[model samples]
Target: MITRKRGAYTGRNKSSAYKDLVWTVATTKDTTLPLETQIQETLQIIDDNLKELHSNKHQIVSAQVYLANIKDKPVMDEIWKKWIGDNPDHWPQRACLGVDLEGDVLIEISVTAVADL
Candidate 1:
């Protein structure tokens, strides 16, 4: 069976889980925030979502990050590294890309993790 968390839109749920794996994505609701704040907020949302799905950052297997500006990757990378912590084992395989996002949104992140259950 699949577990799903509803999203703001009808066409899609925020995240879904099946068996051992849970997938989720997040963006800051307030786009006016600075890039660093946006990344921090989005990651916090991801943290919450992961816990709701019975997992944590350490369980994340992979991640995909989208940025409105490729030029900001250095900034994004710095924050991401801090968030992932110093444990090498906890770092997930991650890829980031510069993409045109909707509205003032500057950053978005998607993650997949294995649930403890």
Candidate 2:
């Protein structure tokens, strides 16, 4: 089994490592945006990171989403459904929770997926 990591950085240092699969955790940078937009952007980031690992939404095994406000769950759900598309079999096990996010970040998403390789 192989593993990969991306966007893993601390302070001013950076690293580039690739393996069989990748697990990524990302948060929205713009909390001022509407919940829907934030969710959409977060999903886009997930998609991009998965692509780097030769994977996609279909390969996702699990996902965790953090929200600044629980009231926005419905809105986030709508966007999440559309983002994952129509493949029910490809949907990952997911959970959402309310949390105190830093800065303007209104939403955060983390996912684990298998690589096509």
**Top TM-score hit:** 1
lDDT of each: 0.95, 0.77
Per-residue accuracy of model 1 over 14-63 as CA lDDT, tens digit each? 88999999999999989999999999999999999999999999999999
Per-residue error for 82 in candidate 1, Å, reads 1.0
Over all chains combined, what TM-score does candidate 1 have?
Answer: 0.98
- Show where candidate 2 strays beyond 4 Å: 1-19
TM-score for each model: 0.98, 0.83
Off by over 4 Å in 1: none
Give the alpha carbon lDDT tens digit for every residue of 1-117 in model 2: 434453545542111224655577776657688777788878888888788768888888888899989788898898988888898998899999999988778898888787776
Flag clash pairs in model 1. Answer: none
